[model samples]
Target: MPKVLNITAARSRLTSLVQEAFLEQKRTLIGKHGVPMAALLPIREYEELLQDLEDLGDMLQAEQEYRRTGGKDFEDVVKKPKGRR
Candidate 1:
């Protein structure tokens, strides 16, 4: 489970909290009034998360472009006549 850190506590012990997240590879959730506000995670994890988001965005854009371009039928591209030059 992720560790919860209130805003004040996180501010007071920012260094330790960051170190703990890095060393343990655990998520640190910063909350305010019992509501989640932000998260602190290892840099590697953060980069992975960002990459996943970018991939998803690219996929969505491609799908939109395909739709706009009158998407091609898969069979038309894959079932070409073998003897055609």
Candidate 2:
């Protein structure tokens, strides 16, 4: 679990928290009214998360296209006969 820091305390240690999260792979959960509102994470970790989301979206689009096409492969749709120029 990530360490939780309320808004005021987190504000005071923002620089150090960034260092901790970025250099040490630690995570800090920032909250207001004792409710988690945001997270601080390393840049690389955030990029990986974005990439995972993109890949999942691509898979969903492929699945939907497959259902619409009744499992026809994309190559089959674009392939030409041997005699074609």
Candidate 3:
């Protein structure tokens, strides 16, 4: 689990927390009034997460397109040369 810090405490140790995230790949959670609100993680992880979300979106779009097109198999749409079985 990540270390949780309230807004006041996070202000004082922001530098150290950032260092931990960058150097050690540690995560930190920040909260206000005891309700968790934000997090700090390495930039690489954040970028990968964004990429994963984009890939998922692309998959969803492809699925919708397939359904709209009556879900024909790729091989069925491509023509084969005669005697090239």
**Per-candidate total of colliding backbone pairs:** 0, 0, 0
Every candidate's CA RMSD = 2.4, 4.6, 2.6
TM-score of each: 0.79, 0.80, 0.82
Give the clashing residue pairs of candidate 2, or none. none
Write one digit per residue (lDDT tens) for candidate 1, span 1-85: 5656789999998998888879988678999876788998899999999999999999999899989998887798788699876
lDDT of 2 by residue, 27-46 (tens): 88999877899999988899
Candidate 3: TM-score?
A: 0.82
Q: Which stretches of candidate 2 lie over 4 Å from their true place?
A: 72-85
User: What's the residue-level lDDT of 48 in candidate 1?
Assistant: 96
Supply candidate 3's per-residue lDDT for 18.
95
TM-score of 2: 0.80
Would you list the C-alpha lDDT of every candidate in the order shown?
Answer: 0.87, 0.91, 0.91
